[model samples]
Each structure stands twice: as C-alpha cells, then as structure tokens.
Target: MIDIDIRPAVPADAGAVLDFWKTAAEGTSISDDVAGVTRLVQRDPGALLLAESDGVLVGTVIAGWDGWRASLYRLAVHPSRRRQGLSRALLDAAEERFVALGGRRGDAMVLEANEPAHHAWAAAGYRREDHWRRWTKPLA
Candidate 1:
C-alpha cells in the first residue's frame, strides 16, 4: 500500500476533485462543479480535505463547520483504493478539525441507496437517523 497524505484542498484542486468524484463518489450534487468547489475552498479553506497517494488523489471529504454544526459530505474513496483505510484517515482529520473548533457533534449526509457508504459510516460510529427527513430547495 502506498503512503497516503491528507491535506486541505486549494482552489487549483477544484477540477481534479470534480473529476475524481465522478469516478469515486456514489452520487453527484448540484454543487459538485469546479466553480462551486472553488468557492468552497476560497470560503472555508480547511473544510475540503483531500487524500493523495503519490500525489494522485485517492479520497476526499468535506468537513464543514458553520459555527453551530459540523457537517460532513462527499466522503469518497477511489474504487480501487476501498477498504484500505483511506476513508478512515480522511475522517480522522475531519473529526480532529471539528474537535479543534469546539464542535460537539458531527452529521453526515449519505445517500440511502449507497449501502457501501452506510456500512463505512456505521463502522465509524455513526448511526442512521431514520426519524428525520431531509428537505432541500435548489437556489439555482
């Protein structure tokens, strides 16, 4: 296994991140584009974390802290790199960031159809909130 390096993403990484997500992530979001990601990096520089093996992107996770809540999103690993502890590394960095920010709890948005993600999140000590329903409105 190659050594993995986890770090915060930069504006220049937006394109590569979008492309990586297309192959590694289970689903797409409206804000998965380059512009959206660039905005994220510019706004909250440490929120978007990237994992690289020999400088090639292998994993990504968004650990967003908005003063009150710590929300996680886009937790993805390269299909070829799955089950190799890449996700765990990313989550560790994310949770550490939250802890440093005085965050009490963290929430993740996982797609219901992505069973693989469900298991991973569960293994990481996250439980599914079946009683809650997600509501969204597209601003675009």
Candidate 2:
C-alpha cells in the first residue's frame, strides 16, 4: 500500500478527478466530463473527497447532504490501488463530513452486479435497506 492521503476536493482537482474516472475499469459509472466535475466541486467542494497516493489522485467519493439525508455516491478507487485502505479512509472522511452537517443517517446505492463495491460498502457498515427498481424516462 502506498502512502495515501484523503482530503476535500477543490476546483483545481477537477482535471485529475475526471482523468481518473475515465481510466477506471469498465462497468464503473464515473463521469469523464471535466466540466461536470468542476461544476460539482464549485457547488459543493466539501462533498467531494479525493484520495491521493504519492500526489496522484487514486480514488474519489462524493458525499452529498440535502438537509435531511446524506447519500454517498461515485466512489471509485484506482485499479492499481485496490485492497489498500484508501477506500476506507475516503469513506471515513465522507461520513465525518456528513455527521458534522447534522446528518443522522446515511445511505449508499451500489449496483447489484458489482460484488466488490457491495462487499466494500457492507464491510464499511452499510446494509441493504430496500430493493429499488429503476424506471428510466428519456427526454428528447
């Protein structure tokens, strides 16, 4: 495991964040749009936690609090950095941020087919709360 550091993301980190997201393994929902990440960071820098290994952005997780509830989203650890404590550290920081903002409970949505993510979340003290079926409506 390389030396890892977790911290809130700033607008300057957007480029690195988008690069990592795009190069991540297939089947990840990480966005490749630098502009989108920049906007997100500008709006809520505290919600974006980034993990760095030797000055490289290896992981990212977004913790969004909407007054009443907090949701963890877009957690991605670099393929090379797997099995290290980076993900756990990112999650811990995210949860701490949530708690500081008066979040009483938290939630995460992991794809049912993504076993590794599901296991990681479970290991980090999350459990299946309910089954949700998705219905997508495309706008033209």
C-alpha root-mean-square deviation, each candidate: 1.0, 2.4
> What lDDT, from 0 to 1, does candidate 1 have?
0.94
lDDT of 1 by residue, 1-140 (tens): 54899999999999999999999998889998889999999998899999999899999999999999999999999999999988888998999999999998989999999999999999898999999899999999
Best by lDDT: 1
Q: 37-139 in candidate 2: lDDT tens per residue?
A: 7777777769889888778888988898878878888788998888887778888889999889999887886777888898888889989867666566745
Off by over 4 Å in 1: none
Per-model TM values vs. the true structure:
0.97, 0.85
Clash numbers, per candidate: 0, 0
The true-versus-predicted C-alpha distance at residue 52 of model 2, in Å, is 0.6
